[model samples]
Target: MSYGDHGRPVFSSDPFGTVPPGGGFFTPGPPPGYPPQPPPQSGSVNLFATLSVIFAFICAPAGAVLGHLALSRIKRTGERGRTRALVGITVSYLIIVLAVVALLVWLLRPTHTSASVGSSGRSPTSSSTPVDAALLDGTELTRVLNQPFETNAGSSQRGGVYGLREFGTSDERTEKCVGVLHPAASVTYRDSSMRTFAYQQWSRPTGDYAGAVISVDEAVVAFANPEDAQKLLARATEEWKQCNSQRVLASWGTDGKFDSWTIRDVDTTDSIVTATVGYTDAGSGTIRMPTSRALALKGNNVVDVGVVMFRDPTKSADPETSGIDVARAILDKIA
Candidate 1:
């Protein structure tokens, strides 16, 4: 039996006012009815948490900040994305550390003779040693090729010149025996007028000027003392490291496609340092020819050789090895 608030007996009744044969009365467990239930509400997603993950790759610091904010918002609002936020934060820190380290290395690295590595070997401290008065030795460079070449088209000579202007990057940015070389600066076309006062110039040999899709030239210039050459080459290995992923305008074309150059391999032995460098089209990622370079200090003289060739992707026949062969020849000649 059930009782109402007025202390009256209560009974369940049909809407039509009919009663069952057995019974229609019911008993209530509580005094008042249960409160009505509320409907479920939707939750909001945290946008900061999502940004954290996206920026992690492109901007680490931003990702870290967004990740932390997202985590905080998630905890407070019970949103999702905890895993994404954490991942973004972790990656951001790692990238930021790498960026800092690279900057420090660039700021602290020795820049004194760094430009001469790519530019000219002539340093104010250098004394044009090793250059023989009678040894144009154009054949010395030609003899380096054990295999067939395009053939030497012609030859060139430069007396009292510090470095070979006829070959190499033609940029003074690597190591500057001279202070005016700028590898980052725009490149200019060199001609006969410029050669008169150029920092580097090499005499041409008989066959051809030795132009190709890729070509490396080697030569030696001695210092007044062996110690100077050794001192200059001390940081050659590190210098090559900076050469990786370098961006430059196409020397052959005005099409505005930049080339990304990289140093693939770097090695050092006593006073010698060698590396293989290659380039790719910055836009299409098309790999171009690669060059191998070796610099060695033989007594009071410094020998440099470079091998240049278009890479044959199908085969492993790298022409850069020719640079090493030429270096060996120079050593034998000096020996």
Candidate 2:
């Protein structure tokens, strides 16, 4: 090497000066006996191991799968991130175990009867007193109907505290007819002091009932005083008497269809009113078997019950007796 004008050393030949025998300007090379060093191994992380950690919080099953794959790949390929794979696996399994335990607890829980719950599986509002709990659940209604019964879809209203407007209508006859069909439609439901209103429709063989033979309905309305309950009973009884032997077309009422009902008879007493109704649809002919209905007053609650028979009533499940029996059972509960 020699110094340039700027006082910097300039290379005249290879600096190490260990040249080859070819006599060209020689360049240094690896030592004669040593093998060439292989390219440095890249230290990239295992892909599965990284995925395991990321999926641990999003999807437990995916995390567990990815963790097992990561362990296998790490062992075969000697990649990094074994600790991350183990952590993901442990957390995923813990979450899975906890979920299984929660499901088991819910499935094995006991059924409650004393406390009334709506079809939605929620209790009534806080304003509901024990008296408002008179509405029967699936278990009670099943026994009353003498068959397995289930709640009708969207036909449950529990823990309601409404004013008389709930029963108001421009047509007097229509209102009276509705009151006869359902005691909750009476003028007493319009009372300012009206309390909780519980109503639910129940049916047997609740699956594929398009060709059903019979159906049952039950309702209960609670008032603050027994006088109000009695007044409701009286109004319903009078309405039934007026609607007797009359055919009323269902427009916007509960039926919500173009069906007509012919009230055959109305039986009224001091506290109970029973009726027999013949039903027909605009397209379907009149159903031979009549529908039996009864309303009973017990303390501050009025119980309404109905049974419609599309076919002949069986001796074991007579429509005429089922409504009366159900009404008695509900009234006994209230008393």
Candidate 3:
């Protein structure tokens, strides 16, 4: 047979030899071996997973180390995650440091205004002289007692002095009965003339014998005695009326739970009388009497006066005694 173009016969067949060009067809194959295709790539690591890592690392120094590890893993695996974790760690540490510094500053702050005493013995904060309890004596007591009873009869300015004393059980229950004094000015209805030198006394019974007295310008004008005590209400009333009327000041008996009397037309020379009469009834027609008074100085411009008295409820009454003497004595000091 004639060969077409190759040395081998064009139509000849050889199992181990190359086939003729137009012989039954077979295609060329790939190179001997190719690495198996990599398994289909999983999608990039989840973004939420990176955020979770950030949260876990926040405020924790170890969080940064963990975040870095995560990032390295992601890079090797071609995954995307862990970037936020690194940022969280740094921010958390910064916040912690700032908070510590703020707390320290607040704790170290101080409060209070500075003050000092001067060489004159006066504090920069105050200059008032403190009251000396030791200085309170009989004269001072009398002056204090008379202060509240002094009254300015018809003057524009009214002033008075008063005094108080504690008596009886000394318990707080009887404390309200403690002595007190009040003095007021007087007025004449016709002339509208004002007068000073009016005074009053308040006394409450705490024990058995109890009463109060009032005086003006060193004179006893009003008094009250407890029922069943030695003193009589009628007598006391008469005495007050006589005293006030003599001064040309009106006085009368008050029909009320507390005995009250008022005087008018008071002047510097004329005494104004006001008083609270207290009474306690002891059985068997006996009565207790305690009296207090207010007085005004005629020559002195100072006019305010007052007095208060307290008595023990449990005590016995001395019928022979009247608070008139005590009242007169108190008023005498003012005169």
For this target, which candidate reaches the highest TM-score against the unseen true structure? 2
| Model 2: CA > 4 A from native | 1-132, 159-174, 186-188, 191-193, 207-213, 252-257, 281-285, 313-316
Clash-forming residue pairs, model 2: 164-190
- Per-residue lDDT tens digits for candidate 3, residues 236-302, read 2334444431212112223322322223222222332333323334343222233333332212222
TM-score of 2: 0.51
**What is the C-alpha lDDT profile of model 1 across 3-115, one tens digit per residue?**
76999976656555545667665444545677644323226667887899889998999999999999887876677777888988999999999999998887765543455
Error of 2 at 286 (Å): 3.4
lDDT of 3: 0.33
Question: Whole-model lDDT for model 2 versus the true structure?
Answer: 0.65
Q: Which ranking of candidates, highest lDDT first? A: 2, 1, 3
TM-score per candidate, chains pooled: 0.41, 0.51, 0.21
Best by lDDT: 2
Model 3 deviation from the true structure expressed as Cα RMSD, one decimal place: 24.4
